[model samples]
Target: MTDKYSAGVLLFRRGDGGVEVLVGHMGGPYFARKDNGAWSIPKGEYEPELEDARAAASREFHEELGLFVPAGDWIPLGDVRYSSGKGKKNLIVWAVEGDLNPADVVPGTFEMEWPPRSGRMANFPEIDRADWFDLATAHDKLSTGQRPYLDRLNDYLTQTGE
Candidate 1:
C-alpha cells in the first residue's frame, strides 16, 4: 500500500553509431532459470539516513558488477513506479557513461540453500551475467518496472546528445 523508494543507474557506452546499456541478470535460484524481463540495473533500497541515493546507487553498482563506477555527473532521468497491490516501488534512475567488460566481471555471491528443502547451501553470483544491449533490446530484457529507465535514457540522449 505504501511506496518504497530505490535507486539505480543506467550505465551506457557508445557503440557502432548507437549506445549500449549495461543490464544485469539477477542471480540466486529464483532468477537462475529466468531470461527476458528478469534482468535489471544494479540497484537496491536505501534509508533516508543514507541521504545520498546516488552514492548508494554507485555502491550497489560496484558490488553487483564487481567494478568501480566513478561518482561523477549523473544525468537524472527521474523515476519509475511499479505496484503489485502489496507494495509500490519507486525506482530513481540516472544515466552514467562507462565501459564495462562482461568477461572481467566477478559479481559478488550469496550463500543460499539449493533445492529448497535439501538444506544444501551454495553460493550464487549476485548477478549471474551482464550484457550490453541497445535500447530496444534492453527494453524487452529489463524488468517491467525498469524499462522506463531505458526509455528515459534514450529520450535524454536524443534531446541532449550525451
Candidate 2:
C-alpha cells in the first residue's frame, strides 16, 4: 500500500445565487466522457516534508488553475482521507473567499501517451474545463473524494457566522 498527500484551495464567493465555487473537470481519456464524478478541486500532491499544507495549497492552486487564490483569510477545512486502489490519498483543503472568471483561466498541461500502448505522446490541459457552480451543483459535479470539502467549508462558514 502507498500513501499520497495533496493540498488545494476552495475558492468561494457570494452572489445572488448564494455561495459559488470554482472547479475544473479532470482532463485525459479516463475522465473524458464522464461528467458526474469527473470534476475536482484545483489541487496537486506534494512532498509533505518539503512544504507546509497551506503553502502547498496555494502553490498547487496556481499550478493547476494558472491563477493564485486571491489574498484573504484562508479557513482550514482540515484533512480528508480516501482510498485510491491499493493506496490512500489524503487531501488538505482550505476555504478561501475569492472570485474569478472561468473564461480567464489558463490551465496547466501534462504530457502523456494518449492512446495506451502507442508510443505517441501528446499534451493536454490538466483541467479541460472550469466553471463557477453553486454548492448543490458542485456536489453533483465534483468527484466523491473531493465532495467533502463542500460540506466542510459550509460547516466552517456556518460556525464562524460568515
Q: RMSD of each candidate?
A: 2.2, 1.2
Best by lDDT: 2
- Residue-level lDDT of model 1, residues 2-110, one tens digit each, is 6777787888988785989988999988888888888989887777465588877887788888887744668998877896335988778788888878887789888
lDDT of 2 by residue, 1-162 (tens): 769999999999998888899999988888889998889899998888988988888988898888988988988888999976558999999988988888888899999996987999988899998999999999999988889999988888788888
The TM-scores, one per candidate, come to: 0.87, 0.95
- lDDT, residue 134, candidate 2: 92
Candidate 2: minimum summed lDDT over ten consecutive residues — where?
78-87
Instruction: Point out the worst 10-residue segment of candidate 1 by lDDT.
Output: 43-52
- Whole-model Cα lDDT per candidate? 0.83, 0.89
TM-score of 1: 0.87
Please identify model 2 stretches exceeding 4 Å from their true place.
none
